[model samples]
Target chain A: MSYCVNCGVELDRTAACCALCGTEVCNPSQPVDMTAPKPFPEEMQPPPPNNRPLIAGLLAALLSLPVLVCLVTNLVFGGGAWSVYPIGGIVLFWVLTAGPLLSRKPRPVPLIALDAFAVLVYLFVIAALGGQGLIVGLHWYLRLALPIVVVVAAATLFPVAYLRRYRADGLVTSAILFVDAGLALVGIELALSFFAGHPFQLSWSWIVLISCLAMSVALLIIDRSPHLLAELRRRLHV
Target chain B: MSPLRKKSRPATAYAEWFKLDNAAKLYPAIHTGKRASMFRISAVLAEPVRPELLQAALEEVLPRFPAYAVRLHSGLFWHYFGHAPGCPRVLPDIKNPMLRPRFREKPGFLFRVFHYERRIAVEFFHALADASGVLVFLKTLVAAYLARAGGPGVAPGRLPETVYGPGLLDPAATPDPEEFEDAFLRYAHLHGPQGYREPKAYHFASTPEPIHTLHMVLGLVPVDRLLEAARRRKVTITEYLAAVYVDTLLEMQRREREVLHVDPRRRPLPVRLQVPVNLRRFFPTKSLRNFSFFVNVSIDAANGDYAFDEILPLVHHRMRLGLDKRTLAASIGQNVKPERSLALRLTPLFLKNLAIAEIYRRVGEPTSSGAMSNLGEVEMPPELADAVERFEFSLGPSFRIRTNVAMASYKGTLAITFSSTCKETDLERGFLTRLVRDGIPVKVESNR
Candidate 1:
């Protein structure tokens, strides 16, 4: 029997080198077993076909159909370039869905920013179809839709970014949710009032906002008082 | 000879489809490209395998395993097997066998055939069948090939069949199919816990190897010496090996703690080995589909240090208790009960997949330090057995299990093959060296 001189572990009679340490054995008295059975195949097979290109081709084919149909309809009907609506819609939809699927690793910030841009462009198409000039379209997109999407996206992205760095307990997460909901509601009202050409006036949003604030305070109090939290958990059987 | 002539017709001539057997339903739901649940069972022949002959043997044997020929089709509430288009090709053996996504290449076929030099191997997605199920298929294929190659007293017309019964060959056997039925669902009851659950155990962390590069270390030893050692310990070979494995992990843990100067008051995680039990032994059925579950044997280090002797009895007793019929049925019930739930059944396929994958991630590998599947003795007809050199079993890397062992004995050699996705060789080295210290000679091999 042959043994690995370096590690002192028993070596297969056929091994030229130690399987564990890769030290070549040079024994004149006991030659290596040259014809031992190999455990794995030496030759590697051709890699499997990469289907990314196929997926891209299929997506392109499916996405083009709607734009082509809409472009044809607009030309035939001669109705104020209405084709832009479906064209923009299709492009916007692809950005939101297929864009992430096409990538090996997707960073959420860039993808979400692209989605927000797509929404603005789609709205711009509507504004242009309304016979508004570039100035009016820009005004509505910049003043209304852009601000609302930004707040909504921030509401999502900030929490995700925070949670990614550190885990939050259930109570902390619920508290954040309640406060974020109230802030989002307030932001929506401000943006709408700006569009209506009215001063910052709180209406039904105040009542909902107050309720959200109260919920957040209650959750905080329960978090601080462990006994109350335990009692609640028992009652809810959570 | 009488049986061969009486029922020699193709098994598939009767049906082109089948249902995913009881133990196979969960695989289709959670399987992915990276974490594909697949296992490989291979046989080494006395002569180099000819590609054409292996292909011919596959063509002959493919019709016999009709259950393995179908492709997976997702239904609203469940997944079913449908007939694949053409025959699965017998390809050249690849470096990595089981981890590659075979279903994507051959959309419906659940198993693949590969030949490398003198070795002929088949890798089956866990959805296809357990190791026991695949072994019979592989043995039959090898038998047919040897017969065609002109083995003594063996004829190509009569391939060696499983001892399960003659219902395998009859074309009318499909009328009362029992093997393809999900035995788990058939015998599921709420008598015990649905599945084994435990607190997450410690994982062996390491510098991750390159993607798709799994390191394998194989140790070959005489079956007699190991059996004698087990006899001395008054435990089975599996129990003995598991004890050695747990002891190795404990040693590693103690070393890590000593180096880091960690407090003794801190609770050390339990070291558990997930032993897959072949339900076929407890339940009677001839079906070759997946009919197995796992019994987790654990040693909690929080109490105190355990010697090798202490761990062996603990593993033996735990294994006996875990194999209880009612307990196994309850475990089966745990899995099937979820499938039977109205809420889960009504959930959309995509949602169900998400839920299942999440649960598997949390509860699957973290609960076990490693898995050791003992395929037991491999037997073949005397004529065909003479033409075979050895048999090996390999399980692909799991999401959390970085290292695992698969063992099978043929002739006088017991092959213990370790499939690992990590760079460290501590666990394998420790286990083998302990055997050597105990006076069992080991001949180590590797696929570096």
Candidate 2:
């Protein structure tokens, strides 16, 4: 056996250098052994669970149980066909929470639109069950809830689309958000007024519109002029 | 799975499907199309490779390795392996070969076999197997090719041949059940005491080259000279090489400290090396799957500066302690315990993947300065061995750890190949130069 000159420990025949230090072995009297078996094993082998897939498929099945229970309870306990509302609500909830998990690449825009569509469908079902029928109930639902939900979706979606397409910074994104809020508020007021059979007059919307306009103008200035924006940011601790 | 056909093969051609082993579960969870945990083991022959014969050999030898005939599949709680529909096709090697082989790109295969001039390369996604397993596959493929192409001496019984003929690869040979076992789980004590904790280790810093382009530095060292060097050092070759790596890392840290003008009071980070222990050595299993775990062999720079001589014995001791059966079992228990937890078992695959990736970032590379996977010596039957010139093993570049060193010896040549995604070559240069300084003969080759 050859001893390590540096550490005074015995070396393995297959060793090329000291395991402890970075010292190389050099021995004239003791030659390196080449015929010994290596310390490691040479052979290799083929190196479990069905319940997993069943559980995933069961997720849809399990989630549907709550909707089923609510439907039966509403129809049995109550006189009117009010079960449609809770059933629609549960279905909409599932679409929002679990639908994205199914997709390879779930973006925000399409998912948000899907959420809005689910809510609209739910409202139409409620109108049809609680009101006259699909014909007259849907007419009222389209006039009121459809316009309101569409405007709300547009308000959330428009800014997202703009920000994504332009790759906007915080200042630009905030400005767009503020401007869209004002427009959505105006749209809500217009839809309510027209459905309510009253003249469209901006009341709560006016205050929101002015404040949003001011914030949008300030953000636009900050985005365009870097110097004043830095000063304002420092002074306001923003 | 599409019912419609494109280039569909006959149903009988597909091989048996198998599940990913316990150690392999992490790879499939974390692998993306761009960043996969993969490695390559290649054999360079004395003569240039013929693509047609190599393809035929691949076809011949594939039936012998039923475990490798798999593709990734999504299950409810975990990802799994399913039998791919067709046989893997051999192709001419690409310019840069270790880029993640997407399941779609390879048309459902998890591994690729490539031939370029004199070299035959097998690149595997870690989900398929480890370095040792790849070496076996490469040797068997090469052996089969030589017999068919009339190139060299054919070792009749040594090659994997079917009962019917030489062209059919082990058609009747049943896959050993032990080959597919999770040796870690089988050997580990369910309630065993946990292993030691790892202190944050020093990491080499460098500006990375372009993504997916790992620079390979292959140092061809004569086995005789290296064996002599280790003998004089009075340590195993693995221990000696690990010490050299630690020394090089320490030097780099000192330079960084001087350049950055860092405070002297700040404790020096530990220089730790993650040395993989093949579980097959400890457990009586012949698994060709991932059956290995690494122990962090370290030098505590916090204890103060360590001279090369001082660090040598410490590394030798650490390696011994780290490889002890109980120590390995305890470490394996720690990993397997988490895997077997009821909470973790119940978790959905996607969410578990996210959690696993985060845990790896926090606990994986931080515990080690670098990884040194010594595949030791690859011994083939004398007749097949005579035709092969060299064998090379390389760990693919990792995101957190920029450089990983892998070495395999064949035909009296120890080819230590270092793969790094970083632009810096300081560690490799320093280590090789140290060997040369110690009178060990080393010839270097690089793909920069």
Candidate 3:
């Protein structure tokens, strides 16, 4: 029942190597299971890790911490204002773009869509309830909220669809991620100054929101297909 | 449990780009964040002939090798614990009138730190220390020092001991202050590598992955036959092999695209290759640390569909022209000055690498397609045959780039082997197969 992972030649139980190509056969139940994994002998590799699940879980928790903190802060200090709802927006961003959710796996579209939907709902709730607390008008919400909504929606949903269909991936290279993160951080800093109680308010949260949106979308597209990234790395031929 | 530490942290605009660029600049990062597997090649020499004897004769080994010597001047000799030899410390001074320009207003650090044993190391720091200009030259100084430490003049005979490295670096050893970092290449604004950019190719937090290596021995015809073959080709053997590699690469690039359904337009990895050229061809130096400049030739993926034969001559031509005897001679005779200042030269290496790192972003992740170093012919007296059965060569990558080719001939046979620290093995198999197809029989001896 075993077949070559490469070339797909059917294998025999006792075969030490591919009868046709001489590639060592990896059939375990067969008498010649010993021929498996040759060429790349196991002794040459580093020790394998034992705690993959723990590692993944930890990474996921670490990524979501910022979102958790934002929620806590909003309920306590956000004064029941729709403005505080961006905390939900922030959390939504992480759920979609960060952690295990963002790692390489088969069919990431649906999973990503769910996170984006959650974030969108949270943002919508915040926008819908904006004027009730903590210094606000619908105009501020209109400008910032719409952008947040558009970006979050695009980042959350677009990449999933794009990746499912397989297209326009290089747009999310690590370089783009770097640029996005940097600009978003600065935007957040700048937004604080234009609104809120302090010289700068969470209005700057929009910067991170945008970065999160961009990064989420970009990573999804890249994950969908890394043809461009792989080509670049291969040419460097390092 | 506490959350795992994240190496990829969000950064502010300018800082983040700079950080990532610095990461890209490092040869190791360029190798995909892989750890460097250490290589130690040892060749035992004849018993304790006077150290000075071998050192004295080193200059005669090759016309292109650097020459310079180190002396403690007695009182200036520094020392560490239970010293069998070497100073606790000694400064590395500029030697060989040929190196006057490479030296700065202040004497270099190499002049200060003396080796603890008879060993004279030629080391290239893995971006953790001095800039390449200083480190490589220092090693050249060490090569020259080998000649000096051996003595005034070594008559033609076998070296008494082994002269190879993987020599221990005693972390606890104390030292005096003299430094490396060549005094060349002015980092100015309005030009690329603009205004004092640092050379420290930084990797934020991801530790390098473990590297795996397997050695192979392929016996071949003697150096004489290889030389004969080269002469027949009307090209240096180095050129011949380089052609083979270039051709093989072009083939592989084509196959990868077709098989993977990849776009054929873009070159796989857009890289700038650095080929070290001995400056000794330009200037006469009695010093071994000649401080050579690497000539870079990038593979143009845009020119992908082309055949190797078509491109081979162009590469051969460039390397030959770059190494032209008369050209280097003329530059050397010009008495050019060292490029940078002492303190200023060392500063960028420590602060942060901006341009060297942003290579991928600015030039499009321009990675080095590994490196090709044809040490060419390393001829010793024919009498040293039994002690040195066929010779071999291996080149180490600087910081960002891994994987390199080193070819040398000792016996009458011409043998070649490709070395890679990476896991993928297609490049090696493909290279060997093509050479065999070209009529050179490949007898792969399984060491395992």
Model number with the top DockQ = 1
> Poorest 10 consecutive residues of model 1 chain B by lDDT?
B1-10
Per-residue CA lDDT of candidate 2, range A90-209, in tens? 777777766565544547789889889988888878877865778878777977899999999999899887787786657888888998999999999988887777758767897898
lDDT of 1 at B377: 86
Worst 10 residues of 2 chain B by lDDT: B1-10
TM-score of chain B of 3: 0.52
> Residue B265 lDDT in model 3?
47
lDDT for each residue of candidate 3 in B271-359, tens digit (9 for 90 to 100): 33446665534543322222355554545655445565665676678677767654433333222221123543354442323433455
Judging by lDDT against the true structure, name the best candidate.
1
RMSD of each: 6.0, 15.5, 16.1
Candidate 1 regions with alpha-carbon error over 4 angstroms: A5-8, A13-37, A120-140, A158-238, B1-14, B104-107, B150-176, B190-197, B251-268, B301-307, B341-351
Docking class of 2: incorrect
Consecutive 10-residue window with the lowest summed lDDT within model 3 chain A? A39-48
Candidate 1 lDDT over residue span B128-166, tens digit each: 789987888888778767756744455455454442233
Whole-model lDDT, candidate 2?
0.75
| TM-score, cand. 2 | 0.64
DockQ of 3: 0.05
Question: Which residue pairs in candidate 1 collide?
Answer: B22-B182, B71-B108, B179-B287, B194-B334
lDDT, model 3: 0.40
